[model samples]
Target: MARGKEQPARRGGGGRAIGRVIPWAVIGLWVAAVAVLAPFAAGLDKVKSDKVVDYLPSGAESTTVAALEEKLPGGGVNDFVVVYYRAAGITADDRTTAERHLAVLDRKYPGPPTDSAPPSIPAGENGPHTVGADGDKTTGSSSRVQDSRDGKALLFAHSVGTASGEPSAYLPALRKLLEDRPAGLEAKVTGPGAIEGDIDAVFDGIDAKLMITTVIVVTVLLILIYRSPVLWLLPLLAVGCAALISMAAVHLLAKNFGVVVNEQSAAVLVILVFGVGTDYALLIVARYREVLQTEADTNRAMSVALRSAGPAIIASAGTVAAGLLCLLAADLNSTSGLGPVGAVGVACALIAMLTLFPALLLVLGRWVFWPKVPKVLPAGVTGAVAGQARWDRLGAWIDRRKGLAAFGSVVFLGAVALGLLGGPGSLRSQDQFVKTPESVSGFTLVTRHFPHIGGQPITVIAPTAKKDAVLEAAEAVKGVSQVVPGRSGAEYAEITVFPKDAPDSPAERRTLKALRAAVDKVEPAAAVGGPSAQNLDTATTSARDEKIVIPLVLVVITLILGALLRAVAAPVVLILTVVVSFAAAIGASTLVFEHIFGFKGIDPGLPLLGFLFLVALGVDYNIFLMHRAREESLLHGTRRGILGSLSATGGVITSAGVVLAATFAVLATLPLVPMAELGFLVAFGVLLDTLLVRSILVPAVGLRLGSRLWWPSALGRHTDPEDADGQASVPIGRERALRN
Candidate 1:
């Protein structure tokens, strides 16, 4: 009989163990495959090599004068103009140097205007058009400050790219090109691009800051968790490898698949690795310890823990991955890129925790609890705090009175939530990037010197082939104090008008409505497309998504919680808790925006962003609690189960929260408005989830519902252990509880 049982047990152990680890592999492989495509990682390390070299004004002046009339676009339509004013005359040498620098940069630029206009006389609408400032003070020249008295000054500026791309990367090269000039000349490339370029410069310091913080925080947490430098070794190794490979994959994918990582996504990746990876390892290790107390044999305990805890971890990872995927609905490309990349990181965390972690456990399990001698303790206390009498006493004290634990969670979350009143807005604008020095300088320079440079002039285009109705459509608008019959070409007609600003300001909205109404009357293939048109498109896009994404993510998150818990009520309660927390997070972020940022309205996109992050991370702790509660309840009973689960995983969750919170908090240091808001919002949300939702609401809900919480009809039901479905099928605390 013994031989027969032993043979079957060995076969079952080998087969079942392999089966249990499938979710880990599947989740891991799927993500790794998607992330390996970044092409822009390093640029041969030369910060200022081969930038723009020359930009010269040709004196073929009168010869090309007709070309200028053909494309006589106003100041706003003109690209950037660089101003290099000297105290003396600008000779061929000065012109030669500035022109060469500008030319080098100009060569790399994808030529102005994405449309098909022949590259004729690149100066027509696109080139080194020179102009004097409003006045040359000494000469009292009417053409202004752009020109120096002795002609020693040179001004250089051009539209780098649609005024859409950030300038930091390009600005440095421009600055260096000027700095490397044959001396005595000052060149400042003041444009939207230049300003953005400077802000990007500040970001260079971030990678170093993140590296130090990760090392310190991880080292400290490891020391506290394992108490043995030896045991902390494997988990640290796992996180490092996972983070490195995950990042490499994101960059690689970005390089190849066209998914570019913005500053926000790049910053979030480090924190994601530490927090998510650490959470997975902690769950597996805690379960492994529980298995040890009863199994005695280390191998059996290791196999046993993997078979049980691995699925929960994988399911937790799925929720995170799915939450990130919802970003595809966002209008911003920066946010859209985050959706898939964050999922990839979660996948990496799952893999490292499941495979490499198990192998490490096999080698290091014996020595993991060293110095303290591996003595078994009652259920729920990790060896990390095993020897501390005061902690044990406190743990016991909490076990004795659970009500206080419940109340404290309510008080803390409710208070932090009070800030919710400040959140506002419906759209985050590109203008937010203007808060930087480069942007401010560019804005001031343009506003002061180029009065006609504020807006993208509205252009109505109809085929050169259509004249009657098209021209009629153009003539029907009410705001047109004047309409110039059509200028640019047979193919393009330019209508100049002084229409009121509608949709943005109330009075303007009225003017726009009338203009739109008149346009409708003419109905000439008319679809709006300039700055106002883009805003209308953006508002439409945001409104449509608002009606959709959040509710959908919430539903998906709820179903995920239910399925992960394997209980009907548990998922429902967890969903509700997460929803309430999400509301509070949004409300709090709103308050931060209104009172602190002093912005008018919330960015239309901020709500979805806050909602998704809160739901995802908040539910992460929920998974920890439910899995812990079920394990502890089966081993002990309902009341003790809640206490035991809290004690075992609570500390780790809180530590993960601290690291995540701190990393996101770093975003506030950026020069851009959106980044500052995003940083604080995400950091504060994580803190609320870690401190309140996981530790308090979950335990309190568990306690309040008691056995009823796991109903419909049974969940991890512990009793006679002979049944195939019995919860205590292999519980360590079962024998002791039976004896008691």
Candidate 2:
């Protein structure tokens, strides 16, 4: 009999050994994969394309111009302005030094070397231009050095050959050459080329900075939530692995599938991985801790925990992935590319948290909780018996005043949402940066000195046969200051039109519109493009994308929620609550932006990106609560189940919310206006959803509706005896009682 018993015990031990081996094997494989792909992942930034045209809508006028311009004589032209200023009035010496510097630039960085003979010039017109040492003559289309009306400043236009295909590559050397100045004269390079360099410089080192800040923020929050020196490291380590995997995957996708990754998308990807990964880890860990209070065996506890929390985690990830994927429908290439990049990050985080996180916890066992170690309960004791009486009382209070709580919550959110009406208008390119760069300062100096000249001229392309007609119409437009004819290709000619207003001013936008209308009437095939035109087109496209994409995102998320909840009423209510939460957050942010922070105006893409993140991510907390409540309702009935789920999930979900909010808040520390605005809106929105919407409004509504909250689901039809009696269906003191 002893031999027989030992044989059975040995067989059982072998079975358990296999279970232990599987998790380690999975972890080891992931580690090896990460090591193999780490190099490629590190090179992702090397492959990113930040071309201006890359971000615009494919069919936009600006995009068409960019493509056509590349096919011109020297491939294209990189145009910039060198402004020389003196508060005492520009002196002769200033002009001499500026001319000498221009000559040096011409010799060193000659424009496209002409292959064909100079075109014959018409009589009385500027004679056929001679190729200067700069490679192209300063033609009628080029603005040569001219004194400002005030005599305080002089501006000269410089063009370089774009045949090399990297206009920005020449900026650093040009900026350096211009840095040596003559006394009493200040020279600054401003225009598209210089501005592009400044923007690229801002994005430089952004990836490393973003990673450090996000990691620090997440680490701090995890320490606070876990309160365990050791426990926090587990999720942090898991999330870090997820980030690495995500980067590698994104790199591969971009390299193989031509996915676009810019500074914005890359930064957002890191935050998503850490934020969403930590959230999934929290849910799993919380459930595991609860299970540990009953099932002393660590493996058994995790098994039960995963089974309980897996559906919510999986469903939440699915919803986020689906919502982000909807961005593919966006007309803006940058916005569309963000969809896949962000979705990949979220998917990686989910896989790591569900697999690596659980495996690590099992391997480390209950001791990982350290000083706050959970203990197996005594026979009659329960999981919630230790210190949750506050949550119980809070639940009871809300249950009693359901109507008051619901009404009060709605009123508060609605009032905050009214601030949307006072928000400033669309943001312009000049206002895109949080802090002024050298190029912007230079542009401002030009505006002060040359009050009549636009910062960047509007470029128009018309049929070569109608060149004179196009120029005449452009010059006759209301706001036009001058029109200069440029190079002519096979069938088209380029004209540079200077407007009276500043490049990004409201007056300038109107001028561009008027110019377009006038030019189109004279030359039907003409196209208008330039820095200002690009900005206008971007804003217009963003607005159109908002109208189309917002409704689609809503439909997608609603269908997802409906499937996950298995109840039409519950999904509708959740969607409405999240939408209200989003509106309230945007409204509150608009006030902060306009009055407190003094932002110029909102980015045109703000509403769409804000809605995409707020609604999809906002509903995550609701999903956690409702999924748990639905499970409880099967056992305890709807009202009791709602209270029980809130009590059980309240702390963990709040912790998750804080983690996510803090992660996004990292973007506020960046120097870009759009990123900062997006950060604040999403962060504040999440907090509102977590603390007020999920905790107060959602619970109150669930209590008020009772079983009807679940409409058509089996839980809606099932009612416990205690629910009918208007008593607590299950005692709230302990997890066992709450579940019972």
Candidate 3:
């Protein structure tokens, strides 16, 4: 580096004053913003809903039933089935104990008991029917106690009005009523309502847990990456600021615009902001350090860093936000709600990192990098160190054996993809939790003692005039064991059908379809809905959403890359690598779920969510690499530029990737199966993209294309030696000239 190449250590009086004042001004603005928004952020949880109806597809029959249920005289109902059992078989004493528990429930949780409440078994049926606490037929009451033929279990089925609130609010007290059961009888509450209660309980303190854990994980990793106890705080602080802004923004959207924010989306929002905000910090810091080696003025160094690295950072954020926003197209409420929530988070992160983060860095100055603070170097001396030598050599080798590198990378990704041999299986509600709750245990017990009767009811709402035809059609379904008439409303009537198979069983699904078809023919206005039907609709709707959203996300990202890189070929190559990496990640995750974690099956929506994350976040590293490569290629030839860019960015990009992966891996701490599975897949996919896809395959492809990699761009053609001559003395890594 020559002296002429160095930027002046001091600037004009006006420039210096403005530069000094700008940082403080930016800091003040952020403080005010945080002070104003913190309250709303704290209120974010108030708007979140985790109800089953909230997550189901908007137009699904189950969703419609849930909406219509609210319109019935006593429509909003929570149904519970309490199971009492003794392995030795229910003795006469056990029956008495069960009846006492039923009496307690009836007295404590008794609803107004409208026609819309779940019906009791008809008299003289083959199976056991519910009897009142005094052993008489319980008519027009919400509680019913039935015994199993095996003489080992007793089931007390009941309904309560949902007017109080979600089942979670009152179910705990109801379950507590059963805690004093006789020692010989094992009592547990299980049913659709109880299962939902358990789920809500799992997410009770999830945000706090995820926030504390994520902050700790990111803090530790940042400390290690920066190697300075004090230095790591800056990025973390900036990310916290971003988190507050995002939380507030999301809360407003959810409160005012009817955006769906569930526990899962809220949890994920935290991880995304932290992971992505920290990533932007890493890239900016690396560029700032690079600029500081030549420009002594902190302001000038920051300006140069932002000018050079800011486009990639913006593009990275845009790509991720755009990809997430594509989720708006999903039919599932939870899935669609996540789109804007995540996009807002990413946008907030971008705003904070690009604005507040840089200002904080400038205010702190070189001390921010204290232990190994970058120093100004002589004009002809570069910042390249021995650690970067490996990347230069690797780049040269990749260039020399481009074909082999590409082939090996493809083969490796494909091999990992072999885990998809057995398709990602469908997850059942019972398996949705990593640890079994009492609801699951109770459901299992009920199924064991009453295998012939479905433990869950399939609800059918039909026009009052066609109730008889719908009932006959529902009973005609192959897997249906009984069709019980339910309360009649002004326009519609309820018909409860019991399937012979379990709710999650294949036979139940078949029966659901057949029942829907049969009823549709008899009464077009009739809708088949219930816990089982909800599961079926969610799976099918999620599959449909994947087809629509994934392709849109791909196009959105490619266009972002094309505009940022200003090149077609490079963007296409990067997109391809990201897509392949996504597939491999999904494949590997499927195997891990089935074998390592022992998850029963994958969530139907996991693939779409995983694809969005892997592609958007995975392409982030390539944007940093290729953007730098494009800048360098204009000066040096494409071969040397690619090598130099690789050497320069390889360290920072890998660090960013590790940070992201670690943040997402935090998701595994959650008890929900879907969150854990998603966290693992994204984490694994990120590492794959950084370590192999970006590091080797992408660079190799770029090197093979040479200057032509920037098709349609001026840099794609011959570079003007005179233009290159102005910076011929621009210092680069000594090994960057490695033979190709």
Candidate 4:
């Protein structure tokens, strides 16, 4: 008998040793993965493109113009204006200096060589400079230089071949050429090339700046939430690993599959990884802490924690990933690309938190909690009683006034939602920068000095046979200042229509609308496109995508909730509450945007992108609540279950919310207007959902419905409230202890 007992004891010890080895093995594997991926991840920013055509809908007229322009004689071009300004007037010396600058530009970057070029290329295409019959460069007649009506601005139209490479490369040289301006003359390079350069300069620091800000925000919030210096660092380190892995995945996808990534998408990726990953970490750690208060073995406690919290974390990640993938259906390339990029970030976060985080916590054992470490309680003393008393009382209070709570919450949310009625309009290009860059300032100067001359002209493509009719109709449009015929291909002809108003002004949009209508009447095959047209298409497509994607996301999330909760009524109610929360968030954000922040209009894609993030992420808190409630309902029935789950999960979920909101809030610190607006809206919306909708409104609804909230499931049939309270009030591990 003694020999048999010894063998059994030895087997048990070996089993324990294997369990200890597993967690370290998992950590080692992840460390190796990160080491291998760090190099590729660092290169993700180098591949981002800021080209406008890259973001436009493939079917849009502007996109078509870009494609056709690429096939032209010089293989596409970058056209911009060199504006020489003087407060008083253009002096003789200014004119002389300008002529000399133009001559140097023509000689250095001359247009395509002409041997009386093909029909595809317009004649006299010796490039930006004029060439004599002898094939020699002419002096100063290369580019078309015009003087503003007020004589304070001198505008020179410069076009460079893009076949060579990115036109933005020429900006540095152009800036250098303009550096030696005449005294008292302000020479600003204001055009597509210059604007692109400024935008690129800002994007150069996006990854580092966004990462530092996000890490700082998350660390501060974590320290406050955990109140344990050591505990907070674990989640931050895990999230950093997730971010690195996410960046590598995105880079690989972009390289292998031609995925489009812009600076905006890349920055948002870092925020999502840190925010969502930390939220998952909080949920797991909270459960682990609770288990530690009852279980003696650290490994057993971790196993129990993972078992309880794993489903909720997975479900939360699923809803967000599915909702983001819906962006693939979007017509806008930038919005579509963001869908995969964000989905990858969320997926990587989930993987890291689920595997790496739990492994780390288990490896560190009970001491990870430090000074506040939970001590295993004595027999019959449950962990649930003291920790959940406050939540229990609040749940009881809301249950008593369920009717009032429901009505009051709706009234308040609806009142806040009225702010959407103001119609903030669409964001214009001039307002795209938070603080105006030099390109914008130069454009402004040009507008002031050249009031009669159009800055960026509207480009129209028509069938070659209908060129004259297209030109006549275009010129006859109300706000058109001039119609200049451009190069004609075999099938199509390009015409540049200069508008009387500024390029992105409301008046110009109207003018573009009228011009399209008129040109289409005479030349049915004609298409009008330019900077203004691109903006119009973006707004229209965004509105359409909102209608389609919102309904799909609601349906998808509802199914996920229903499947997870195993109850139809609860899922329906949860969906309804989240929708209301989204509306309230938008309404509240709109008020702050217009009244407090002084924003005139929002980005065209803001409503759709904001809705996607708010609804998907907002539903996460509800999932955390309802998932735990469902588990408790199995033993405690629906009423007590709701109260118990809320009490238990309240602190952690709230901490998670604040962490997420703070991470998103970091976007406001960036100089980009769209990012700032998105950050504010998402951050505000998340807070509203956390503080009001999830905490009060959802609980109130659940209380009023009671067991009926679990309809179509056995839990819906009310059980003895006294029996459930007596049994479930015991800490989870205590029942097993009593049995032992």
Candidate 5:
């Protein structure tokens, strides 16, 4: 087959050099990057930060409240009704006890607001009131709480806003006050903050849990790959610097540009830098190990490593960064900003892989593999079969059954592909985390007590040219079940339309259609907003975003891949493969959610995110594969070149896939269903990339391409043993050592 030693492969040079020298330099740069926004990350959310209170739930969804709702009061629960109590239970003495208790608890005022100005209280009177013209009162909180039916049970009622807003700051103090109560009557606080506080308490060790897991996984993987503690420190140093720089960059952008970044996302960013960066580091370090095994000259080996693996790493980085850019398509600002932060971080990791990592490798010299001397391969380095004694048998087998290998690979991928029949989750059954705390708790309570609980409310925002009276007029519109006053005085009222089902339910669609007709009947002037309106906005935004962002990301990725590979067809083919892989990933995610997780379909935005992530990272694997294939092609001609490249590159990509997929799979542990489903989908996608796309399809395609695979090139005709194209063909540094 003239397929002698699979193409002359390039070995390690840059990974070790950069591993040794650049981390120190990167330290300075990272600190400077941190200084770029140390003021911000340190204090971006310091002043009444919404991020601080946002996810905290009020007592409504607290476990205790849920337990109680399951017990008494006939049936329904008032989401998180704070029972205000002033009762003269059976006698004046009992009543005074109740009043004294309420005063001690300071239960009358509905808490203070951040502005120090009181929040406009809900229009309803606090429960039922007993009043005479003389302004007499024996009522309110007592009726709701203390005067239990048949006088056997007495409970008081009060009200509080959601924990996510200004109300949350002081909600804790209020709860503490209630807990410190007198005997006979228990002051039980149940609100949104209470629920969140409970979750926090229940999952107190979550951060520690995640950290321990990550460290254990990473340590094991690093030990396996680098085989040295020294090598471990190198990747950490590079990635730590990248993380600091990325965070600083994010803080700076948010501060200067007013781009809102949710605090919850900060955690996601930290994990991403470590996880993805580690994978990239593995690729570079492994290449260095390969290079060190061959050439005696440390510098030359390092250069060869860089020249050969550098393009692949750079290409991978570019693809990952560009894919993250696709996240900008998310209509929600909080989710959208995640894309760029990740993209920028990945970009930094790539640059460090090439520059700083190479510098460190140069400094470390042989010490990088300290504790174990570098293995020297003296057999003219016969591509895949030379020093990889580990996988000789497997390589030989693939060498023996090329057709069966290709067919089995394609068929296996197709089986996974069929899983794509299911679509991503539907908004109707969005994972539970998105439910309004009140809706969730109240639904539970009412379902237990009342045989019939009404459906979800479709909130209507009454828009106005003039702020004052528009809301009043809006409340009077037909088909509206109830009018809840909005924060804006009369300009924007929150009209609740209770449909037969929730907003995403088909029954709600009928309500929406009726509501639209009702709005149409209103004077031509008054503007309105409802779930239908929001849905329309979402659909339009989604469509427009797909049109613009998908193409933009694809174009950017193509350019970056082409530039890195120095080959047009390679990037184009890889991109196509990524696109197909992405579709299959999304399809698989949808099927999982619908069939296994019990969701109806995938999130509308899931495809875009999957496309962005898998495609971009998928490109990295592709580049890594082709670059290895191209290197092999140089020495082994076409046939052996393909075999050698596949064997050598397969292990690294597979390792990366396993590690990455495992890390993402941990997201399934999150209580939120979207995160769980997303985690599974991505984990599966990465697995598919490593097992099917990278190891199977990519090589099959490469083998089929033969010489045309590296076309329009000066090196195209130079693979004959007579022609010498040194990997470190041109020295790339200020000193001989740096030149490699």
Candidate 6:
């Protein structure tokens, strides 16, 4: 302990002021802030929108079409198909039961007019209408019911005015009605409308579900790590405050600034705040405990820990926030919105951990550590010297076998990266759910029975004057099975075009392109959009976002690392390793998704999101290591400094990594496949980085580079006795681990 420098900190000068007065004031201020902000935080879900158009790329044709649809009569309508199936055949009794259900539906919700574009027709109160018929001649001018040629399925199309309500509100009631049927007969309501409803159902209460799961996961992990009854609560409480502040900030941004907040972004915000906030808490507490081993006064010890660990925490948060903000450049609204949403979360977490968290610990003092309370050690002893023998030996072994360790790690990561060869294509909407919902089952039945025109209808908006020409042009397109004219506004008319293949199919994608080309030639102002078109645009925009946002994130991280380390080569090496780590993680995840989980493909936006998280977060461990090494190097030169820093930071960094990875893994508990895929990849990547890259590869590489790792800095050019062979003079195993 340096009495000369820390004497005032131990006395009643600044130390007493911080210990006695500031902590209560900080805690008081946080209490008031939470009271004022809690309602806004709770109101976050009110502003969250998962609408397709809300997340579509700005200026895309689909977005334009969506805007135009809102201006038309009935504000556009929800289209769906009701499929009835029987394995053997539709017997007389089965047909009778289907007719009864249809009649009930028709009477409850009457269609427009027989002449107008009515949604569907149910069997009537009129004379016994023929049941197993094909086409529009089923006793009503408003509806069309088609029986499959194989006599196994009956399919019907319907539309509901969006002005009436969202599909999410009404589809469940309709499905419930269909639930009561004869044995061996199956009924499913599915199409664009039902699919939308199913997706909505998944996100309905996601905020609450995600928050509860993440908090429980973090709480359990913290309790296990601390092994103290009381110590874990302070960090959990601080994280709760951070989450409240973050939700309020995001809600305000969405309400006032029009920043898009979707279910996915909101859910991710909760996980990120809890995970990253706890990580900062772990690092701060570890340093505080170490300082407490030598300093008698808790406040003074915390002051020292803050001074030592604060810069690394701030650098890490800044790097993550910067990388996330790079998504602002993306064309996809969802991707761009996530950038700020996640940044706000990181900022709130940083502030809460640095402020309220430290204040809570200081106010509670040494008693909080309980049974294993930190007692002051002898004058020269520190916590690291008394513990962490394994870390010391591991650092020494890596230091000695630098060449072999670095080469082996690179080879291992490269081999894992080879899993990318088994390509998983972009995910379809039908495949979005981990469990097959009723809508997906119905869609499959529809496709099986109606092969020619089974896909969701693509809506095209064209000038009313050119509607006829546009319809004719669309019908000429190769994949167009049918083109029906929908309602007409004063200037524009809607046209529904059905493709022969299923939605999200390659054939359907081709059909969309051809339809767009044909309609554009007839009416230059026309735009093509629907559920299928939205999917296509979303995939296209996500790919474009990857190209722009990913490189920007890399550049931002590199700059931050360069400034933090005050070196060129070290930052570059860290960036390269994180990038390779991301690749390997994604590749490994792809294999799992394909073979184990039976996922058809990954979400289009996943690549950008995963890369941003892994690269920024993977470098976080390296920043802690290299930052400490930089301080140590100024005294002992690079070789000994890195070895000492590795041993010093190894346990705390690994714990932080596990805490972060576990928090992200909570997302896998959700039903959405995208969330699960993202959760698994990030969790796996963080473990790989913590267990392999940070523990061995980075330290090994640093040793081989020696002083040159800090090139252009004075630390790099300095020569010490240990610089002769770029090895530590005394083996780390024989000495006490370096003091904090």
Ranked by lDDT, top first: 3, 6, 2, 4, 1, 5
The TM-scores, one per candidate, come to 0.68, 0.91, 0.93, 0.90, 0.71, 0.93
Candidate 6 per-residue lDDT over residues 1-740, each given as its tens digit? 24334555236566567568989999999999999999999999889887777779987898988888777776656777788999998776766666666676666544433333643233323334443222233533333555665678776777776655778888888888887888889989888788889989888877888888888888898898888999999999999999999999999999999999998889889989998899999989988988888788887788889998999999999999999999899998888889999999999999999999999998888999987899998876655533479889998888778899999999999999999888579998889999999889988887776665546788898999999999999999998877767767888887878787778889899999999998888888999998889889999999888988889999999999999888898999899988888889999999998999889988998899999999999999999999998877765667778888887888888989999999899887788899999999999999999999999989888888877788766555544566636433433232223222
lDDT of 1 at 181: 70
The lDDT of model 5 is: 0.54
For candidate 6, what is the total of clashing residue pairs? 0
Q: Candidate 2: RMSD over Cα atoms?
A: 5.5
- What residue runs in model 4 are displaced by over 4 Å at the alpha carbon? 1-11, 109-143, 163-168, 384-390, 463-466, 489-492, 521-526, 719-740
Better of 1 and 3 by TM-score: 3
User: 645, model 6: CA deviation in Å?
Assistant: 1.2
Q: Say which prediction, candidate 4 or candidate 5, comes out ahead on TM-score.
A: 4
- lDDT by residue for model 1 over 623-713, one digit each (tens)? 8767777766665655566666677667666766776666566666665666667767878888877777776677766765665566553
Count of clashing pairs, candidate 3 = 3
Q: What is the TM-score of candidate 1?
A: 0.68
lDDT for each residue of candidate 5 in 1-740, tens digit (9 for 90 to 100): 12133234544567555644555675566457656755654553342123321221211112122232223222111223233222223344444544564564434334323211111112123346553332223245322223433232233333343322334344456556554434544334433334444333323344446546665667677787657778877777677666666666666666677555553355456556666777877787777767777666566666667776767776677677766766666554444666777776677666665666666666677778888767777665543422355444555565556567667766665666787764542553323452334324433433232212124334443443432354344455444433333223223222333343444555555555565555545533333333233443344454555676788789888888767655676777777777767766766666767677776445544555566667776777777777776656554554456667777877777777887777677666665555566667777888887777776666656555544555555334333321222222211122233112
RMSD of 3: 4.4
The runs of at least 3 residues in candidate 6 whose Cα sits more than 4 Å from the true structure, single-residue gaps closed, are 1-10, 13-18, 92-116, 119-142, 385-387, 724-740
lDDT: worst 10-residue window of model 4: 115-124
Per-residue lDDT tens digits for candidate 3, residues 600-719, read 988888999999999999988999999888777755667777888999999889999999999999998788898999999999999999999999999888877776678766566443
Q: In candidate 4, what are the lDDT values of residues 564-658, reduced to their tens digit?
A: 88779998998888788778888888888778877768898888889899999989999999989877765555666778888988888888999
Residue runs of model 2 more than 4 Å from their true location after superposition: 1-11, 112-143, 163-168, 385-387, 522-524, 718-740
- lDDT of each candidate versus the true structure: 0.57, 0.81, 0.84, 0.79, 0.54, 0.83
